[model samples]
Target: MAGYGRSDEEWGQLTSVGLAFLVERARLEKTTTYTELDATLRRRTGLRGFDFDQDSERAAMGHLLGLIVERNRPTTNLLISALVQYLNTNDAGPGFYALAVELGMLPRRSSATAKQAFWIGQLNALYAFYSAGRRGA
Candidate 1:
């Protein structure tokens, strides 16, 4: 939202596109890589500002994801970004844990196993919430 200098409408558009993609992934019980998600956002929103190589762009993406999580947290009670991860590692970046800590979903001094368990729980919860009665649909 900051430093990108995009209008509110543009942010809304990006959020809409990203959230829909993530929701669909949740429904399918699938995880998407950051690169794939970036491509989808670019394709859907025509926004080319999501390059993961740049630290600023990556932070912006994390901000976008944080927005999505904040917007949906009340209704879903889940961190949707758990479904998005690095392709090589099939795991989220450190920002994920930082966000969790910021959101009070995880402790600041948690162990690696605890962080992993929290992320897995969030993913499972998202899959269950989004896929409810729609797995075969």
Candidate 2:
């Protein structure tokens, strides 16, 4: 995906949600260090050199989110907007599952839990938002 400029507010919002997802995943997986999470993400996505600090999960997540948002600003902003809209109109959930799936962060054939399904919807909405933005651009 191409990068697009985003406001500070948009970046903050996206970072917040992304961090939440990372934290929750860490908690669920019982990870004690940022290295674990970094390794997991790399293994799952087949990417490398994420710059995880190895100090704290929170710091690592912040750094990773910053890099991802900066690298894929348009899609990240659309993901954040879709997440916020879902939160306001529907329910609480991580908004990154679909983005994750697209980026190979999650497996495509994996059956989503209820919470994940909600996020999946947000992911689908992101595609719609991105399409609209591309047209306008």
The per-model lDDT (C-alpha) reads 0.83, 0.43
What is candidate 2's lDDT per residue for 1-137, written digit by digit as tens? 11233345544544454444443432333212334545555554444434534545344444445454444445344333223222124432233444555655457666647545645565564445444234221
The per-residue C-alpha lDDT of model 1 at residue 64 equals: 88
User: Per-residue error at 71 for model 2, in Å?
Assistant: 14
Candidate 2 weakest ten by summed lDDT: 79-88
Model 2 quality (TM-score) = 0.28
Error of 1 at 102 (Å): 0.9
User: Which of the numbered candidates is closest to the native, going by highest lDDT?
Assistant: 1
lDDT at position 114, candidate 1? 92
- Per-residue alpha-carbon lDDT of candidate 1 for residues 1-137, written as tens digits (9 for 90 to 100): 54566677777888888888888899889999888988998888887757778887888888888887777777787788899898878577788899899888899999999999998998898888887645321
Query: Which stretches of model 1 miss by more than 4 angstroms?
Result: 132-137
- Judge candidate 2 at residue 38 and give its lDDT: 50
- TM-scores of the candidates are 0.91, 0.28
Alpha-carbon error at 112 in model 2, in Å? 6.7
Where in model 2 is the C-alpha error above 4 Å?
Answer: 1-50, 63-112, 132-137
